[model samples]
Target: MIADDLSSKIRGGELSPGVALPPQKELSARYGVTLATLRQALQQLEDDGLLSQQPGRGTFVAEPRAAYRLDSLRGFAEDLRAQGHLVTTQILGQTVAQPPAWAAAHFGDADPAVRLERLRLLAGHPAVHQVSWIHGLELAETDLSGVSLYAALAEHGIAVHRAGEALRPGVLDQASATLLRQPLGTPAFHSERVTYGLDDRVLVADRATILGSMMEIRTEREVSGLSMQWVQLG
Candidate 1:
């Protein structure tokens, strides 16, 4: 009962994100419950992602988590922005170079490709680190700083027809951890995608590391619309 009431307050916006709740003893008194009971209720809320508890600091409401839609064709930044979230992109690097050995397998070894590295932030917190290798396009860093990669590709007459992606659980490495402001070995989601253009030619190969604490993968199912498969990783 206590958990349900507190959850309702949170969902109704009575408890806003980042707002600290009253001290435990005070809350217990207000709710006519013992301190132990109050703590239990708070724990329930925390487990549900409605609150955040810092060891030395008081508990506060958790920031809303962004959803990464499994069925969407839009880029991460574009999808979140459409849901009224503030998303910013930082270009880590961009260069014309030989695709890495892994990417080279997809894009033949004959031509130089544009390699772009980007970091996406949600409400000023780092959320995703992505690197993309694009073949046949001469792109500059400035061309993608504030726009969606798909939108940028469209500007160059490239339209994404479809993409195949694979996802797996991962832990943040030193480089990714530093960029995401998380400790090394933090849990993360790793995704690789190969996108084809309307002409049926592969256009971009992308790899991304998403902070699991800040985002959730979501998809809706219909009678015949979308399906999912689970694979075991060794």
Candidate 2:
């Protein structure tokens, strides 16, 4: 009951982020509980990521975790920006090259693709490493620098209508680790996506490595007679 009450206050904005909790003795007195019981309640809230306790500074409401929508067709940069987070992209490399076997099969071509390597930063920290493969034959001389990849595609009348996506566990390679400022072999989420145009034509293939610590993926669903996917949260 104590934890629930405090959690409700935090969520209701009665206790704002970074606001310290009352002293242990005073809180126990207010709740008419022993100090041990009050401590237990506080510990439970801390475990749920709602509160942070400093060794000597006391407990305070924690900032909410950053969330990424897994059920959207939007770009990562677009999504993050909508949530009021500062987003930036650094183009690492851009060239025409043969894609991996899986990407080649998805594009239904043996020809090369325009490969781009980019690092996405959230609030000045590296959050994801993206590698995109666009059809080379269709865009032989297209310049991609200083523009959103989706915007560039839109210029050529190739808007992404729908996409197929999958996520798997990955280990950070040396190059990726160096760029992301993480140790090699760190666990990450590998996302693979195939974007389609209006006519159901494959437009681009994308692979992204997202840092585990920087963001979380969430999906919502409606539980009726049959389960159905619900709208995504920004």
Candidate 3:
């Protein structure tokens, strides 16, 4: 297909987010040209973050970029401290076990000996609980205790390519209610995540249910092609 034509379609939102584009072979056949022609088109789209290619999953239209400014949200500790709230983490749990079911699978064929887990706090309140899993298998020695998981991963030169979050509301489960100090069955927000490594490998899966009473979240995406899907119950 003509690069100009393809670019116009994307710009017009005709080929919207999460929509898959025709395969290179198909585009080639339709455009009556070589695969190289199609690759050039896909390259341009990818550079713009409007299209994504997954070898096994094929290519698909990307979602809109979010507008949540990373700078506006105070870092966990600083934000709470600013409010005069003491932030402390009791280390409710820590382990380097197999990635939990919630974590995105790293390498489809990785051996079972790789994962990272932690329970974190904000203002002495349980705010983030996480598990990181990756295929490097070499990642077992990475210390994640009180260190930000992202920081630890970066120390080893592993940059996260992109990540997605799925949030939903639910009555707190027994364990969650107890931890977050809500009455049994109180409402909560479960933020589930699937983080990816620079190579597009799933690197972490996290399930954190926060007290809904204290937080409201909003994100805007029109440039980065990342997405956050959330449901509100309270």
Candidate No. with top TM-score: 1
Off by over 4 Å in 1: 1-18, 23-49, 52-59
Error of 1 at 190 (Å): 0.9
- Ten residues in a row with the worst lDDT in model 1? 135-144
Q: What would the TM-scores of all predictions be?
A: 0.79, 0.71, 0.53
Show how many residue pairs clash in every candidate, following the order shown. 0, 0, 13
- Candidate 3: where are CA atoms >4 Å away? 1-90, 100-107, 113-115, 131-136, 221-234
How many angstroms is residue 2 displaced in model 3 relative to the true structure, after the best TM-score fit?
Answer: 61
Identify the leading candidate in terms of lDDT.
1
Alpha-carbon shift of residue 196 in model 3 (angstroms): 1.1
Instruction: Please state the error at residue 120 of candidate 3 in Å.
Output: 3.1
Q: Which clashing pairs does model 1 show?
A: none
* Winner on TM-score (1 vs 2): 1
RMSD to native, candidate 2: 6.5
Candidate 2 residue-wise lDDT, 138-199, digit = tens: 55466654567777788877787988777777789998899899999998889888899888
Model 3 CA lDDT for position 212: 60
List per-prediction Cα lDDT, in the order shown: 0.88, 0.82, 0.60
